[model samples]
Target: MPNAIEFLFDVGSPTAYLAWHRLQGIVARTGAALIPVPILLGGVFKATGGSPPGTVAAKGRWMNEDMQRWAARDGVVLAMNPYFPINTLTMMRVLAGLEGDSRFGGVVNTLFAGMWQQGLNMADTQVLTGVLTAGGHDAHGLLALAQSPDVKARLIANTEAAVALGVFGAPTCFVAGQMHFGQDRLDWVEAAAAG
Candidate 1:
């Protein structure tokens, strides 16, 4: 069986972006299937009784610098997203639609670039439509699908499933059933994959 790596992420997370960038190389080296699981960090925080970084000044301040260092090392341009920590419902919905897509990686990369590097307001219908269409997905149908009751339920279920898996933040990586959280933990993740 092919090794699987499940990645739970939210777009508002710089950590997620950093981890996302790092995963490509890890997948190549380890030959693990990259599985992206979209989950809401805000909801996860609530479920885990945690608060956003801004609510805790000391750690938040340190994380800001840490993020820059990781971005520099990873070579992923780290421009602060203008609309960040923006609601990722639409982004997640779009990604969920791509879960089974043949162009999954392309779609994920485009969404990350659009929201993080390009500073597009991901919540904007037109912006999302454009991103999907540009990526060759049906924009109009996706927009409607994103708002459908079924999609909403699935997104919530996604978050609940993440919580059940003991996820408390974005960028949680599950390798061979062992969980590794954060970009700083890549070494252990790689080890898990190797073993």
Candidate 2:
């Protein structure tokens, strides 16, 4: 049986989006199941004392350049979100609520592209609503579901589980029980999944 690759992700991370974009091809070639685990990056940061690259001016500049290089190398469209460090709590909650639904993949793609490619400021509820609605999702329903206690709890649980698994950053992947951090580590992830 092929291995199941667990992708622990937060949409706020551009590197996570890059990893996610490449993971589809890896999964297809390796015949591995891609399991998406939605976690709050902020929660993980707080739990693990992890800080965003933007916290340091030089690191943030370097990271942006690196992301641009990766995007060009991958031939993927990635624009730096003008509203950097947008709060994604509600969006993550909505993703948690949509888990297992057939529309989950579409929702993920829509949100990722909206934030990373289209420069949508998803941190604003009104902006998110418009973007999601335009993407064919029932924005009102998703927003309502996101506010539900169950969905909120699930997101919290996911974040806690990620921390327990030693995930200090976004775009962490698990292949055959081995943890791989960052989009740059995806080659190892593909090799592990192929085994």
Candidate 3:
């Protein structure tokens, strides 16, 4: 896994979605493999006693505006989810279940695109199923798999692993053990990957 970029993220994070797009460019440029580690932002927050900047009214407004600017700068479409602060427990479990399966990336793309690009309220089971079906997946099967014991454990472990790596937020990247936090830190991430 040397020269690999470990992207610790959650689909619920707008910046994580942006970093998800930007990191691929670095992967293509550096010939470094991208490893996605799906973790729960709420779990991270609970563990770290760290609150998202958007929790405060002023910070919420500023972060929303800033996120839009970053999206425009990166040529990525970012429609803020109408159902912000979604409970991603089930979604993350589905992702964890899909890990190592060929369907993982597609599902990740589906969920992130659904949540961040299309402004879909993924909290609704009906909407979630429709989104996955549109993405060419067996929605019910995936959701069933998510309910299994092992998949739930994997998500918890991933969050713990992220915390152990000192990740307080989503969009964290580590190249050769060097930590680069935030979507805006792509430069340092690329440099470390190249190094």
Best by lDDT: 2
Across 1-195, the per-residue lDDT of candidate 3 in tens digits comes to 338899988888999999998887898899888888889999999999997777899989988899899999989999988798888888999998887788888899999999999999898899999999999999999989989999999999999989998999998988888999899889999988887
lDDT of 2 by residue, 151-193 (tens): 9999999999999989999899999999999999999999999
Which candidate should be chosen as best, given TM-score against the real structure? 2
After superposition, the stretches of candidate 3 with alpha carbons farther than 4 Å from their true spots are none
* Worst lDDT 10-window in candidate 1: 94-103
Off by over 4 Å in 2: none
TM-scores, one per candidate? 0.89, 0.98, 0.96
What's every prediction's RMSD, in angstroms? 2.0, 0.8, 1.4
Q: 1 or 2: which has the higher TM-score?
A: 2
TM-score of 1: 0.89
Report clashes for each candidate as comma-separated counts.
Answer: 0, 0, 0
Instruction: Put down candidate 1 lDDT per residue, 73-100, tens digits, no spaces.
Output: 8888877676766877787876666667
In TM-score terms, candidate 2 sits at 0.98
